[model samples]
Target: MHQEPDFLHNLHQELRDGRRWLDRSIVLAYAAAAGLCVVAFTLMADAGFELFQRIYRWQGGWAVLLWLPAITVAAVWATRRWAPGAAGSGIPQVMVTLDPAVSEHQRSRFVSLWLSFSKMALASAGFAAGLSIGREGPSVQVAAGVMHSARRWLGPHSGISSHALLVAGGAAGIAAAFNAPLAGVVFAIEELSRKLESRSSGLIIAAIVLAGLMGVSAFGNLSYFGRIRVPSLTWNALLPGLCVALASGVLGGLFAKVMAASLTSPAERMNRWRARFPLRFAAGGALVIAVIGLVTGGATFGAGSEAVKHMLAGEADVPSFYVTLKFVATWLSAWVGVPGGIFAPSLSIGAGVGHNVATLTGSDSIAPALIAMGMAAFLAAVTQAPLTAFIIVMEMVDGHAMVLSLMASAMLASLISRMLARPLYETLAHHMASALPGPASTQDPPEPAHAPGVPQQK
Candidate 1:
């Protein structure tokens, strides 16, 4: 056999070592991105909460009427002018970017670091103004941007698939935002990526672990909705569970349908009006929310966190109309193109609905179970992602014992929701994909031969 050159053999060995190093480096980069996202998102959420708390304390509901319209106009203008890509719940943007039909350029248009920063700032501002949105969805977009940008930074040495980074970033974001790692995993598999590639298993886990640790360090190991000590379910619990599920499913389905309808292009009268005069329409939505806040004693404000907790603990004396008010607020926020999310508020709505169910049935003992089911059911109805809905609720409330109940509610609600509306994210994603520019040519461009100052070969 011909002798191999020593230089060639050494180069080969070096290449293999470099490949191994790059692989390890990619993992570190992913973990770092996840950790950074968790910290930034936590601070963003806390700051938004503090802003609303202080403003409300100073003037209460009247402040919303005064501030919300101006805030909505500024926020809407900011989102449209500076970061149109960051508008609305960001999960749809991620989902749209992941579609195979969308070109890299189109994906980058919406998921860049610039847009991510805009999302964080605008979304926090919306929260501060008591927009009925959540921090969770925007966090997903921000985290995904961190990882997506990593692909550009690492160049050929990234050793990470672009799609994988998007999925991992979103998964890790959910894990950190709600302190629910398992739900993150399930969300990645069931919704974000729609498939868990075997090759990416370790990478996804690393990001989740890093983000989860960061969240724990900052917020401690408390459940997003606090731990609910659900007692053993009796036959009595079943009736209320069914009632809550049916109500949440039907109502959540209608909410999804109306929301999707509102987001459509200007062919529809409602969407046309919103299109013809966006600022005015947006202000109207804000005004409606302010009026609801005034009527509900602000129960419908700020993602409904306090009201949900109170209702879940069976201590809230919230108005009978609060659930409807919250659902309408969420719908209006979606229509007005605010930068926050429905994820947190949706659960709160479900909890409120469940409390109503308990009241109607005259059963306090099963309130916790009913509330848990309502969360699973309504979220499932809205997103049409049953597994994600149940797993998230199970993780959030630490109600592992009610897993079966939650799952049943999720399935039933999803089925019922599909009857009323297309999957919310999926419909939005389809619209996004349809609206994107045509794909670029597949042929590769010629490579540069030298650095900027160097001459090219003749």
Candidate 2:
């Protein structure tokens, strides 16, 4: 071989190094955009809580009841008209869109700038309307949309999809939404991608950091839930922890089963109602929530955050049927084709379960631990990512001391959840994946809905 001079080798090395730096710069740009989007999303979600509060303060029960139908109808109409994939906890949409197997049009439909904006607007509307939903799940899809759209803006073929930007966006979204970067990292590994791409490690971390900063800047350093005093684990930790875990897990699993079933079987009543009358079906859900709210003194409305916090503070008791009501509310929100999430609703529900266990078992000695365990287990059951679940609960309440108890509870819950049904988000993702349109246009054609009587459109 002819001798290659050092100068030529040096020039080649320089070009390679320059490309790497350029790639990183591009990622930084993506992170900046994603972080800003999360900031906007946080504000939008806050607007929802504010709206609910304002309405509640102004007119109380009647106002919320009146707002529900209108918001649901508008949210559904706008989402279907402009962004069908925006419906439900946006996590499933992000999950399906992240799949390399998805087409360009489908990806845009599920995770795009338009979808991100639509998710924020509609989800916020749902919250303000007193729907039992959370903003965190929607934030995942919204962040994915922001990053993906930024990639498209970077260039027609900026290779955004070819890289791990979607993965990074999802992880960053969780970090921003929850203010828990470690949980976000764990969520990415255990839930979103379920595998790490060595090339994208730096990209993922940078995105998470930037987004988390945006959150901190906007909200200040607030805990999702204040620190709790978990009793020092005596040999007594096992029994109550187990009780909470098993109960939370089983209940969570059952909730998932009902939801999945409601959308799956054409012969099922939910299918019949949704197929022939989509709008009516959503109205029915709204009605159920409203009635529940009325019966529960409006406890069933919103994301149930206040109630959960109250319980954790030991300042107020969870209502007797709160777990059951919260489940129904969450289930109804999922059933309706609306932009919302069950994460907070699920946590509140888990809190209710734990409180009930402590009360029923009369285990006041370790009540707080049981409650912590319930939150971990229930979240695990819904998400089917025990480590992520427990980590999130641990972070929310600053309950690091209860890690072992939470871990055991979370794992047990997830295992039981696995046995009862498909993971909630994954099953929802399956539905969303099928609904993705082919790559014929930037906008997707009408989705292929699984609702029994609803006809698919081209």
Candidate 3:
């Protein structure tokens, strides 16, 4: 039999009621919100995949070259016309929302909702047309927007409460998209929210768990890439793995620098030229399509998840040419105004690099380890979130045994990238947002000292 509460409980009630009740209600509300988010994301992913399959069957090769450009133009135009803040990864918009400098007029609920829908529709269409982008980033924005919209019915104070739920929804979306619960939670903390307060942590964790459960129930308990088997670890392979990690990290840093330079240079140029915006964007789109066709033979278009799986399975034997193609494709995709996430493409690039290195060295034993390490290293370098990168890969591959090497690689890559320059997303967003006309401010608000890159003030 259960025992009743004792004198301590009675004393607690005597201490305070308002704070205690509010805390309890917040926890309960968050739990409910997280559960709802999980259900929504699961449905969305299934629908998105089906829609993409149908589009692929209908479009054929022109999917990448023609349809992608058209959709990209529409999406870009919609963002520029209605929701300029949603132009890029959407993370920056979230940062801007939290910025104190942003006036109330700019932070309208309608803007968030419109941006969310546009991102979802455009990202979904991009995936359907085989563009090199992932769904995770867009999903985060969509989910957060959904939570934010729900605040209207929950009362005025719901906006304040929605912040926590927004983080939760984002975590749920990531978990559902990638089937990585821990990574979702870690990412929400490390990359997006950049806060570890108890309220936030509790909500995010709750959301991740609910989303994971929903994903398993609907999609089965499978890693994003299925079962990635790593050969048994050995001391002899350690040196080569380390070397691969170091190289990938350095290269990843250079990649981040390249993206930042591309984004910022264009902004600087725009200031000088004051060029026609649509014409410039269209030209960039055309260039991206041409480069993708030339370099990848059209293989690098879209999310590149299939290509990544092929690399992991050791099915592709194209040599360094393959990695080079992917790198170019990814760069072009980003350089153009395609609304998508780089995480998957980055992983594919890393895998190709690792696979090429292994082939050159004839070190089959260490190839898998190197591939995994390369992914962590490159991602850490680009995003400047070493721990999040490590955990994300570990969760995606379910490779707990590879943790030590992943950690080492992530640290090396993140350090090298930091030495090279700022985190890619922040730098790109800052410049791009600034270049746009209107009342929007370009300067980032004072972020928490501990927050990665730039902090968004509450």
TM match of model 1 to true structure:
0.90
* Number of the predicted model whose TM-score against the real structure is largest: 1
Give me the displacement of residue 388 in model 1, in angstroms: 1.1
Q: How well is each residue in 217-300 modelled by candidate 3, as lDDT tens digits? A: 666788777667788877877777777777777778888888777656745664234235763564465447545643555556
On TM-score, the stronger of 2 and 3 is: 2
Question: What lDDT does model 1 reach?
Answer: 0.79
- The Cα error of candidate 1 at residue 128, in Å, is 0.8
Tens digit of lDDT per residue, candidate 1, span 1-458? 99877998888895877665576577557657665765786688668867776777675447768787788888898888889899988898898777666778889876888988888888888887787888888878888887777675454744567788888888777888888888888888777775766776777777766766778787788887888878888887778888888888899889888887788665988788888888888889888887887788877878877787787787987899888888988888878987888898899898888888888999788788888888889988888778878988998888888899999998888778877877788777666666676852232222222221233231
Instruction: Give each model's whole-structure lDDT.
Output: 0.79, 0.77, 0.64
Q: Output the TM-score of candidate 3.
A: 0.81
Q: Mark the 10 consecutive residues where model 3 has the least summed lDDT.
A: 445-454
Top-scoring candidate (lDDT): 1
The model with the greater lDDT, 2 or 3, is 2
TM-scores for all predictions: 0.90, 0.88, 0.81
Worst 10 residues of 2 by lDDT: 449-458
In candidate 3, list every pair of residues with a backbone clash.
130-302, 131-302, 132-302, 447-455
